[model samples]
Target: MPNSPSAKKALRKSQKRRLVNRSNRSALRTNLKKARVAVEGQPSEAADDVKTAMRHLDISAGRGLIHKNKAARLKSRLAKKLNAALTES
Candidate 1:
């Protein structure tokens, strides 16, 4: 429904960006889930998984895909979970 040529081009560009962003967001979520699972099920590997998840979160925050504060909060929660798991065993 873009009337002008420029508008059409912009729409196309937005669509491409949407797809890329979606993929990145999905990957981030997957990493977070994996980290949570590792923390709960395999404390031995939780540290590495948490590290990878934190790195992904930092990258996503830097790229403006997620808010910096939210990323920090997630990192904090994950760290807490990892620490708790470690302390238990």
Candidate 2:
């Protein structure tokens, strides 16, 4: 338990931040999943999803919700999948 008033306030702020981060993280994961599914389904459809997902990833990374390197890696993998799908079709 927080003993000081400042500590109590800090705890409250932390809880709020945690909730916000959780919501944002959930959104990010959902966007990533949508992108992956679209990439697996059709290259044309995947383009928009990938772009949206990448945008979300960038925002999340910038906000410290996710690691920048992981975001870059995911974007790379998505692009690779998109390229492969385009070539295959």
Candidate 3:
């Protein structure tokens, strides 16, 4: 329905971007889930997954895919869980 050339190009670009963002977001969610489950298991093993998830969060936030504050909060909570698990073990 885009009559203008610029609008058509913009729509194309947005569709491409949407696909990329969706893939990245899916990966991020998977990482976060793994990290969370790991945190509930063993401290030593969980640390690496938590670090990976945090890295993904930071990268996604920097790329403007997610809010910086949301990223920070998730990282903080994950770090806290990791620390608690570490202390308990």
Give residue 10's lDDT in candidate 3 (0 to 100): 99
Tens-digit lDDT string for candidate 2 (1-89): 99999999999999999999999999999999999999888777789999999999999999999899998998898889899998999
- Estimate the overall C-alpha local distance difference test score of candidate 2: 0.93
The lDDT leader among the candidates is: 1
* Per-residue accuracy of model 1 over 1-89 as CA lDDT, tens digit each: 99999999999999999999999999999999999999999997788999999999999999999999999999999999999999999
Can you give the TM-score per candidate against the true fold?
A: 0.96, 0.97, 0.96
Local lDDT at 52 for model 2: 99
What does candidate 3's lDDT look like per residue over 1-89, in tens digits? 89999999999999999999999999999999999999997778887899899999999999999999999999999999999989898
Q: Which stretches of candidate 2 lie over 4 Å from their true place?
A: none
The residue pairs that clash in candidate 2, if any, are: none
What's the C-alpha lDDT at position 51 in model 1? 99
Q: Stretches of candidate 3 above 4 Å error? A: none
Decide which is better by TM-score, 1 or 3: 3
36: Cα error in model 2, Å: 0.5
Q: What is the lDDT of residue 68 in candidate 2?
A: 96
User: What TM-score, to 2 decimals, does candidate 3 have?
Assistant: 0.96
